[model samples]
Target chain A: MKNTRIRVLIAKPGLDGHDRGAKVIARALRDAGMEVIYTGLRQTPEQIVESAIQEDVNVIGLSILSGAHMYLFPKIIKLLKDKKVTDILVIAGGIIPPEDIAELKKMGIKEIFTPGTDTKEIVEFIKTNVNTI
Target chain B: MDYQEKKRIEEAKKQWENRILNKVLPQFPERKEKFVTGSNQEVNRLYDPLDLEDFDYLADLSFPGDYPYTRGVQPTMYRGKLWTMRQYAGFGDAEESNKRYKYLLKNGQTGLSIAFDLPTQIGYDSDHPMSHGEVGKVGVAIDTLQDMEILFDGIPLDKVSTSMTINAPAAILLAMYIAVAEKQGISKTELNGTIQNDILKEYVARGTYIFPPLPSMRLITDIFDYCSQELPKWNTISISGYHIREAGATAIQEIAFTLANGIAYVDAAVKKGLDLDKFAPRLSFFFNAHNDLFEEIAKFRAARRLWAKIMKERFGAKDPKSMMLRFHTQTAGCTLTAQQPDNNIVRVAIQALAAVLGGTQSLHTNSRDEALSLPSQESVRIALRTQQIIAYESGITETVDPMAGSYYLEKMTKDMEKAAMDYIIQIDKLGGAPKAIEKGFIQREIQNSAYQYQKDIEDKKRIIVGVNQFRSEEEPMKDLLKVNPEIEKRQVRKLDEVKKKRKEKEVQEKLKLLREIASSEQNIMPPILDCVRSYATLGEICDQLRAVFGEYKESIKI
Candidate 1:
C-alpha cells in the first residue's frame, strides 16, 4: 500500500485566466512523485468535479485569481459531496482573504494556501494527510 | 603553496569557520531550518567564487552595445537617454483615458502606453451582452474609430511613441490607429508605436487571446509583413515576457520562454517567404522588472546576448539591428502587495531602477494602488515621479552598464544565459514553442515555479514584509478608483450609435471581403483596414475570423 502512487487533481474554476500559480503547484506536486491532473483555465465547477472523478484523484487543489473564490469553492465542495466523493480532499489557493478562509473551511475545504505559502510545506502537508493507495 | 597565499587562505577559512560556529549556528539552532529569499530561491549561508567558476569576461560578459550584448543593448544606454517612462494608463471611456494620456504627456512622460479594457481586448463592442459588467473595469473601452479618435484626441502621432497593449483584436486596433492618423493628415510611415500582437503568450500566460494559435500567428506575421513595407517606423509585435513573468515564471524561465517564442515568430515569418533582416529589426520585446534587482538585470542582459547569438548564429541575420533586442520594461504588478499598499511605491521605484540598470529601451512603472484597484490620479503621478527621480537624482544613469564589471553580476549573467540556452535547446527538442505549448510544457513549468513560491510563503520560510512579518496593527486602506456601472451603459449606447450611423451595406461588403481574404493565403491586414475604416465593430470583425479559425480549447495536463 505504501508503494502505491498518490493521484491529485489541480483545477482552475470560473473565468480567470491567471494560471501561473495553479501551474506552479501542479508541477511541484508532480515532481514530488504525485500523479497530478491539471485542468486548464476557464473551468466551471462541474468541469472540475467531473475531471476529479474521472481522474479518481485522492486530493483536489483549486486555484483562483479573479476574486471569484467565494462563488467557485462552495460549488466544487457541493459537487464532490453530491458525487459521493467526500473522501477526496479539497484545498484552494489564490488571492483569498483571511475571513473567506474560515467560511471555506466550514464548507469542507481542508487547507488554503495563499501568496506566501511555500512548495515544501504544501508537499509535506499533502504527503502526511493524503491517504495514498 | 606560496607562503603568503597559504597563510591568507588559512586565515580566511578560519574566520569563516569561526563565524559559522559562533554566529550562524546559534542563529539557526534547528539544523532542519531552510533559508529562502523573496524570489523563492533557497539561499545558502554564502556564495563563494567557486559558485561562478566558468565566468569569462570578453566571451560571455561583453561590454555594452557590442556583440553578444550581455551587459547592455546600447553603447551609451541610459547615459545618453534614459528609458521612455510610459505608465499604463486607460479606463472608463476613451475620453477619460485620453485625459489621463494628456496628463501623463504634460507631466514629462516620454511615451504613451495604452491599457484597453476587457471588452476592447476580446473584440466586443461595449454594447454586447457578454461585455455587460466588464466595459471599463480593467482598462479603457474602445469600440470604433470614434473611440480611437477620442483616445488619441490631442496626442500627435509624429512626436511621441505609443504602445498599445492589445492582442487578438490587435489588427482591428492598429487599423483604427491608422485611420486616426490619416484623419490627422499624418502619413503611416511617419507614425511610430508598438502593438502587443504577441498572441502566443496570450495562450501560454495572459488569457486575453481571441483566435486560435494558427490564425493568431498568421495575423501577427501579416502585420510584420505589412508594417515592414507600409509603416516603416512601427513595431508590429512586442514579443512579451512581461505577462509570462507576471503569470509566475522564474526569471530564467521568463527569458528562455520569451526567446523561444521569438524564435517561433521568426520561423513563422521565414516560412512565409519574408527575409529575416527585413522584419526582424522591427521585432521588439516587453519584459517584467521584478523585485529581484540583480536577477532582473541579469535576465535582461542574458536576454540581449541570447537573442543576438540566436539571430546571428541561428537565424543567419545580417543586419546588426536585426540581432539587437530592444525591450520595454514594466515593473512586476504581482510583486506589489495589498498588505502595505504604500510600500508598493518603494517597490516600484526599486523595480524601475532595475529596468534602467538593465538597459530597457522603454518602461512603465506599476502604480502603488494597482493591487486593490485601478490607480488613482495621485498614485499614478507618484509612479511617474519614481521614474523621474531615478533619471535625475540617481546618478545611476551617468554610465552604460554601470554594474558591468562586478564579479557577482557578470557570473550571474553568464549563469542565466547558460540556463536560458539549455531551456531553449530543450524547447527546440520539443519542436519549438507552439509544440511545447500544445503539450503544456511551458505552462507546467510556470505552474511549478508559482506553486513552489506559494508554499514557501505559507511555511514562513519566505518572509514578505507585511505579510509573514513586520505586522502592522492598524493600516488604513487607500482610496481606489472605482468605475461606475453606468459607464458600461454609456459605452453600449455609444457603440449602438456607431453601428446606426455607419454605412451598413459598405460594412457588410468589407466584412465579406475580409472573411474571404482571412480564409485564403492573402494578407488579412488590407481587409481588416477596410473593415475598421468602414466602422465595423471589433466583435463583428473578430466573429468573422472566429468563424474561419475556430476557438481554441486548451489541452489539460497536470
Candidate 2:
C-alpha cells in the first residue's frame, strides 16, 4: 500500500482547554499540504489511538498543556503497542517541562515540541520523518 | 476644536507627510512598510487633532462614574485605596493550597483567586475514571464540601474576597463555598467574591463546559435569582474575555466576544423574569492585559464605554451601577515565554502598569516561571511585588486616567470601541453568543487569529522579545513548582473515604431533589446547596444534572 500525501492526526488527549497551540499546528500542517484531522478537546487515550488507526495517519501529534503528559502520553503509547499498530509516529507539544521530555521520548514519543516552536519546524519534521510507502 | 482648526491640522499633517516623512523615508528607510498592533489593526505614523474630528467629549468621554465610563470607573480611581493585588495560585491538594493562600495574604495580597484542577472544573470527582492522571495537577482538587473546607481553612470569608476560576460546575462550587462560609459563622450576605460563571466563554474558548446552552443558562439565571436575595454583596457572574484572549483572540475580539456573551447572559436572565437592576449590578468582568501598551490600555477604556452603552441603551437599565463594567485584569499568560523565563517579570510589570492605566478594578499578575509550570513561591512573590511596586512607587496611580487626553490614545480608544461594537452587531445578527458558538463562528474567528499570530511570529513580522527575535541559551528552569504525583493518590483516597463514610441515602435524596428542581421552573441553588451540605461529591450532583440537562458536545471546526 502506498500513500500520496502525509496524513496526520492532531489530538488533544487531556482535560486541559488550552488548544491554541494545537489548533495553530493543525492549520499549519494543513497549510503545508498534509491531510490533518483534529480530535477536539478532551479526547481519551483510547479515542486518540482509535482515531489515528482509523484515519490511517502516518503521524499522531498529541497536544497537552495539563502537565498530565507523564501519565497520559505513556498510556497512549502503550495503547498503540497493544493494538498491534506500529507504523504511526507519535509526537507531542505543549507546556511540558524539560526534565520530563527524555522520559516521554523513551516511552516512544518521537519528539516533543515545547512552547515557542515554529510551525515550519513541525511541518519539516513530519515531512522528513514519515515515509509515503 | 472647531472644523477649521481640524482642517488646518489635516493640511499640516499632509504637508509633514510629504516634506519631512517622505524625505526621511528615502534616506533612512523605515523598519517596516507598515506598523500594526497586536490585533493587526494598523497604526498611523502619528495621531493628531484630525483623528478626533468626529469625537464628542461629553457623549464619548465622560467623567469617572458617569455614563459611558471611558475615562475611569471610579471618581478617584487608584488614588482611593488602590486596586486589589490578587494572585491566582493553587496546586496539589487542599492543605497545600490552603498554605499558599495564607502565605499570599501574609505577603500583602489583598485577595485570593482559587485555581481548581481539571476534574473539579469539568464536574468530575477525584476518583472518577476520567480524572485519572489529572487529579490535583493544574490546581487544587476539591471533590466535595470537605475538601472545600480544608482549602479555605483559616481564611475568613468575611475578611478577604475570593475568586474561583471555575465554570460549567460553577453552581456546585459556589454551593461548596457558601457551605464553607456558613461553617465559619459567616453569612452569605457578608461574603464578597466572584465565580467565573461565564459558561458562554467555556463553549467558545475554554472547553470546561458540561451541559448544553439552554440548561447552562438556566443554571446561571438560577444563581442570579438566588443571589439577589441572599448574597447581595457577592458578584454573581464574572463575564470573562481573559480566557478568550489567552485562547488567541485579538484585543478587539476579546472585547466583542466577552460583551457579546455578557449580552446573552443578560437576555437569558431577563427572559427568566429576573430584575435587570438587581442582578446587573452584581455582574463583573474579567479581561487579559497583553503586551501592547497603548492598545491594551485603549481596549480597557473602550470595553468600559461599550458595555455601559449596551446596558443603558440596549437593555434599558436605569441603575448607574448596572452600567459600570468593573473588571479584574490578569497579565496575559500566553505572552510569557519559556526560552528566557526571567524576562517574564518585566513583561508582567509592563502589563500590570497597562492594567492600572486602563483603570482595572482588581488584578492578578502572572509569575515569572508560569510558562513552564505552576509558579514557584519565589516567582509568585516577585509577581505580587510587581503589582506592589506599581501601586506605591509608580506615581501613575496618583491620578485618574492619566493617559486619557493623548491624541494617539483617544483615537485608538475610539477605534477600538467602534471595531468591537461592530463585532457585537455581527454576533447579534447571528442570533447571539451561544448560537454563534454552536455554529462555530467564534471558534473559527479565534483560530484564524491564532494561526495568523503564529505565522507572524514564525515569519519574524511580530517580534516576541525573547522568543522570536533575541537568541538566548538558557538552562532548564529551576525552583519550578511541581505538583506531587502522590497528591493524586491522596486526593482519590480522600474522595473514596468521603463516599464511604457519608450517608449514601441522604446524598441520593439531595441529588434527587436537585434533579427535580433543575427540571422544574424553580431556582436550583437551594437543592444544590443541600447536596453540598450532605457531603455529596461534585461528580454525583453533576451526574444528575447530566441526566436532566445533557452534556454539550461542541461542533469541531479546524
Candidate 3:
C-alpha cells in the first residue's frame, strides 16, 4: 500500500491577527490532498517551530502579516537548524519585501509566496519538494 | 509539431477564447450559456428584465431614506453631507495615539476610530507578563484610567464621534471612556461614539476574545442596557462584519453572519426586558469593503434591505431609526500587496469607491504601506487624501444609491439577500449565533470560504496584480513605520508610576467589587465603571474577571 499523505504546517508568527490569507492557504492545502495543521493567530516563532517539529511535517509554511518577517523568518530558520530538522522544507507567505526575499532565501526559505501567488502553485511546490511516500 | 510548440499553441488558444468568447457572446443562447460566469465563482452578475421576473419596482427599490431602505438609509447621502471620513488609527502608547488622533482631526477627518493594541484588546496591561513584546505593537496600549485620560487628553468626547475596535473587553473599555468623559466635565448623555461590542464575530473570525460566548454576550447586553439609559448619543454596539469579511468570508457570508449576530444581540437585549426601539435606534454596524466592486455594492444594498425587514418584522421595531442600518466600511487590508506597494493606492481607491457606492455611513481607506507595516505618516496622509479625492472629485456620490433600479444591481441584491437569508436560517436552525458560534459552524464556514479563495488564487483562477502576474523584482516601498522596543519600556514605566501613585485601597476595593459583580448575575458595567474611576489598571480589572470567567482556549480547526 502506498502512503499518500502530504503534511503541511500553516503557522502564523508574531502578533498579526490578519490570518485570512493564512487560513485560506491552510484550507487550500488540505483540499489539495495535504494534511494541514494550522497553529492559530498570535503564535511566536518558537511556538510555530515547536509545533512544526512535533508534528514532524514535510513542509513548514509561515504566514507573517505584521511586518515581523525579517525577525521571525530568521528565528524560525535558526531554530530548525538547531533542531537538525533540515529535511523539512521551509517557505513563507505574506507582505515580504523584494529586498528581504534574497536574504530569506539565503537563510533557507525555499520559496516566498507573496499576495496573489495561486494556491495551485503552492500545492504543486509542496508536492514536488516533499515526499508523499 | 513539437510538444512545446503544440502546448504553447493550446495555451494561446485557451487565452484567446477566454478573452473573446467570455466578453462577447450575449446574442445567441448557445453562445450565452457557454459564456455565463459560474454562479458561485461570480458571487454577483449582470441581470436584465429576465432576471427580475415577477418584480414590482416601486414596492422594492423605493426612494432613498424610505421604508425598507433598499436604495439607501439617507435621502441625499453625500449630496447633503459626505460619509464621515474616519481613519482607524492607533499605535504606540496612549499619548502617541492621542497625537495621531489630533492630527487626523486637523487633517479634515470628520470622526475618530481607535485601534487598541492586542494587550488592551484582550484585557491585559502593557506591564503584564503575558503582554511582553506585544505592547502597543499593533495599536495603542491603554492600561488604566491614566492611559485612557492620556488617549483623549485634549479631544473632548462630546465634540467628535469615536469608534473603538474592541470586543471581548468592550465593557471595560466603554467604562474607561465614560470615566474619561466624566473627568472632562462631559455628561454621559452628551457623549457620542461606538464600542465594537460584537463578540460573536470575535469567536467566529477575529481571535482576540477573552471569555467564552455566554459571559461575553451577557457583558454586551449589559452595555446595550447601560447605553440606552445613560448615553443616549452613544452607539453601544457596532455589529462588525468587517472582520468576518477580512477573515475570508464571501459577501453573502459576511452579511448573513453579521446580521445573524446582530439578531443574537437584539434577542439577548429583548430577553433582558429592554425595549428594542430604545436601544436599536443607536445600533450601528461595520463592514469590510472587499475587491469585488459590484458584488460589494449589492451586498451593502441587500444588507440594508434585509436588516430593515428583520428589524421591523422580527423584532417589532416601529421607529424608522430602529430599522435603519448604518454602517462604517474599511477597505480590505488583505487585498494590499507588498510586492509593488504603490499599486495598493489604486486598490484602496477602488474599494473605497465601492463602499461609497454601497451607501456606507463612514469609510476608512487602508494606507498602501499597511501591507508591509504600520503606515508611515506620509502614507496615512495619502490614504486620507484618497477618500478626499473621491468625496470631492468623483461625481459618483452626487446621487443616493447610484446603482438603484439597475437590473443587474437589483437582481444581484435580491440574490445576495436570498443567500444571506439562507445562512441566517441555517444559524437559526443551530439556535442562533451564540449556539452556532459555540458549535464552530460560523468558523467552519469562514474557514471554508477562506480556503476556497486561497485555492482560486493558487489555481490562477483569480488574477491578482503584481503577485502571480506582472511580476517585478525591484522594491517599491522605501519607508515603513518601525516601532522601537523602547516604547514598551516607556509604557511599562508609565504603568508602574501610575500604579505607585494611585490610591491602592480604593483600587483594591473597586477590583474586589468588580470581581464580585462579574461572578454574580449582575451587570458588570457599573462595577467596571467604579474600577475605572478608581484608576484600577486594565490588568487588575481583567485579572478579576479572568479569575471569575476563566480564560478561553480556542478549539483550532483548519
lDDT, candidate 2, at B460 = 94
How large is the C-alpha RMSD of every model relative to the true structure?
5.6, 1.4, 7.8
- What is the alpha-carbon lDDT of model 1 when measured against the actual structure? 0.84
lDDT string, candidate 1, A1-133, tens digits: 2797888889877656777777777877887899988888767788899998888888899987655576678988888888878678788888665666789999899898876456777888888877641
Global Cα lDDT for candidate 2: 0.92
Question: Please, what is the TM-score per model?
Answer: 0.84, 0.98, 0.89
The candidate scoring highest on TM-score is: 2
Task: Provide interface RMSD per model, one decimal.
Answer: 4.0, 0.8, 2.7
lDDT tens digits by residue: candidate 2, A49-128: 99999999999999989889999999999999999898898899998888899889888899999888989999988887
TM-score for chain A, prediction 1:
0.95
Clashes of 2: 0
The two-chain DockQ for each candidate, comma-separated, is: 0.24, 0.82, 0.37
lDDT of candidates 1 onward, in order: 0.84, 0.92, 0.84
Poorly placed runs, candidate 2 (over 4 Å): A1-3, B14-19
Candidate with the larger TM-score of 1 and 3: 3
CAPRI-style quality class for the chain A–B interface of candidate 1: acceptable
